[model samples]
Target: MRLLAFGDSFVLGQGDPDRLGWIGRALAGRPEVTLYNLGVRAETSADIAARWRAEAKPRLVSHEPVRLVFSFGANDCSSDGGAPRLAAAQSLLHARAILSEAARTAPVLMVGPPPMPEPGAAARLEALNEHLKALCGRLQAPFIDVFRPLAADGLWARDAEAGDGGHPGAAGYQRMADLVAAHPAWRSFTGAPET
Candidate 1:
C-alpha cells in the first residue's frame, strides 16, 4: 500500500526530537506499507490545494494501492500580524475542493489539525475543526479529530507550551499517533483487521 500524508509542518513532524512525527509513529514497524511524506513547512490550505495533486501523481504510477491522508490548517490559522493567514471560511473552501478532487483518485482520510497553545487559538481552531468534521461526514470520508482531545491532554499541552505552541515534542506526537492508530477508520484504512 502507498500512503501519502499531506499537510504543513505538523505533518512533517517538526519539533520532534526523534523526528518520526505522528505518521512514522502511527505506521511503526509496518513494512507492508510505503509512505510518502509530502508535508511542507509554513503552508496554508491554499498552498497544499495548489500542489498536492501534481506532486502525488508521479508517485502513484505503480500497481500498489494508494491512500491519501490530509492534516493541515495550523498554518491557515496562524497569525502573521493582526489576523489569520486564511480565514476559517477560506480554509473550508480549500479543503472541500481538495478532498472532493482527491477522493476520485484514491481513498482519502482527513486528519484534523492539532491545537496550538496560543491565545484565541482555541476558538479559531475549534470552529475550523467542527466544520472540517462536518465536511468529512458529508463526503463519507474517514476523519480523525485530534483537536479537542489534544487540547485537554497534559502531555500535549506541556510540549506545546514548552515548544513553538503548535508542533509538540516526541511524547506529544506519540500521543497523537496513538489516537490515529486507535481510530476504527484508521485501522480499516491501514488494513488492520478490527479488534
Candidate 2:
C-alpha cells in the first residue's frame, strides 16, 4: 500500500521521540507500505486542501493501490484573539472539496481532529468533528473520532499538564495508532489487522 497522510502536527508526530508518530506506530509491523507523511505543523484544513494535490500527484505510483488519510481542523478551531482561524462552514467546504477530489484519485479516510489540552477547546473541536462526520458520511468516506474518546480519557490533558500541550508523547501517539489500526474501516481498506 502507498499511504499519504496529510494533516497537522499530530500527524507529524511532533512530540514523539521516535518521530514515527501515529502513522508509524499504526503501521509498525507492516513492511509492505510505502508511506509519505505530509503532516505540517499548525496547518489548518484550508492549508492542507491547498497543498495536498500538488504534493501527492508526483508521488503516486501508477501500478499500486494508493490511500489518503486526512486529519485536520485543530488549527482551524484555534482563536488567536477574535474568531476561529477558519469558520466551521468554511472548514467543511474545504473538506468536501478535498475528500471529493481524493476519492476520485484513491481510497479516502479521515481521522477527526484530536482534543486540545486547553480549556474550551474540546467543545469547539467536538462541534467541528460532528460537522466533519456528517460531511464524511455524505461522501461515504470513513471517519474516526479521536477527540471525544481521547479527551474523555484525559491522555492529552495529562501530557499537556506535564509539557507540550499541543502534542502528546509516544504513548498518546500509540493510543491514536491503536485506534486507527483497530478501526474496521482501516482494516477493510488496507486488508491488514492491527499491528
Candidate 3:
C-alpha cells in the first residue's frame, strides 16, 4: 500500500529529527506499506487548495489505490483573522474540495490538527475539527480526531514546542504517531492488530 501524507508542518514532522517525523515513525516496521510525506511548513488549507493539483496530485496519483493522510487546520487557525466561525468554515470547505478531488483516485483519511497549546486557539480549532469531521462523514472518508485526545490530556503539550511554539517536540510527534497508528481506520487500512 502507498500512503501519501499531505498537509502542514505537522505532517512534515517539524519538531522531530530528519527521519523521525510522525509519518515516518507511524509507518515504521510496516514493511507492507510505503509512505511519502508531502507536507509543507506554514501552509494553510487555502494553500493546499491552490497547489494540490499541480503539486500533490502528481505524487498521489502515481501510487495506485493511494491512501491519503491529510493533516491540516493548524495553520488555517493560526492565520485566520476574520470571524472565527467564518474562517473555519471557509477552511473546511477548502479541505473538502481537495479531499473530493483526491477521492476520485484514492482513499482519504483526514487527520484533524493536533490541539494548540495557546489559550485562545482551542475554540477555533474546535470549530475547524468539527467541520472536518462532518465533511469526512459526508464524503464517507475516514476521520481521526487528534485534537480531543491530545488537547485535554497534555500529550502533545507535555513538552516544550519547537522554535515556533506551535510544532511539538520529538515526544509530541511520537504521541501523535502513536495516536494515529492506534486509530481504528489506520488499523483497518494496515490490517494491523488492534492496540
Candidate 1 lDDT, tens digit per residue, 125-171?
Answer: 88899999999999999899998888886788898678887678999
The residue pairs found clashing in candidate 3 are none
- Among these predictions, the greatest lDDT belongs to 1
Span of ten consecutive residues with least summed lDDT in model 1:
116-125
Clash count, candidate 2? 0
- Residue ranges of candidate 1 with Cα displaced over 4 Å: none
lDDT of 3 by residue, 1-107 (tens): 77778898888988775556777878878877777788998888888788766765566555355687788888777734544323776887898799998888677
Against the reference, the lDDT scores of all candidates come to 0.90, 0.87, 0.78
Candidate 1 pairs with clashing backbones: none
Tens digits of lDDT, candidate 2, 78-190: 87656788888999999999999999999999998888854555568889999999999999999988887888887776765565767888888888888888888878877
Give me the overall lDDT of model 2. Answer: 0.87
- Assess every candidate by TM-score: 0.96, 0.95, 0.88
For candidate 3, the clash count comes to 0
Window of ten residues with lowest summed lDDT in model 3 = 77-86
The TM-score-based order of candidates, best leading, equals 1, 2, 3
Best by TM-score: 1
Worst 10 residues of 2 by lDDT: 116-125
Put the candidates in lDDT order, highest first: 1, 2, 3
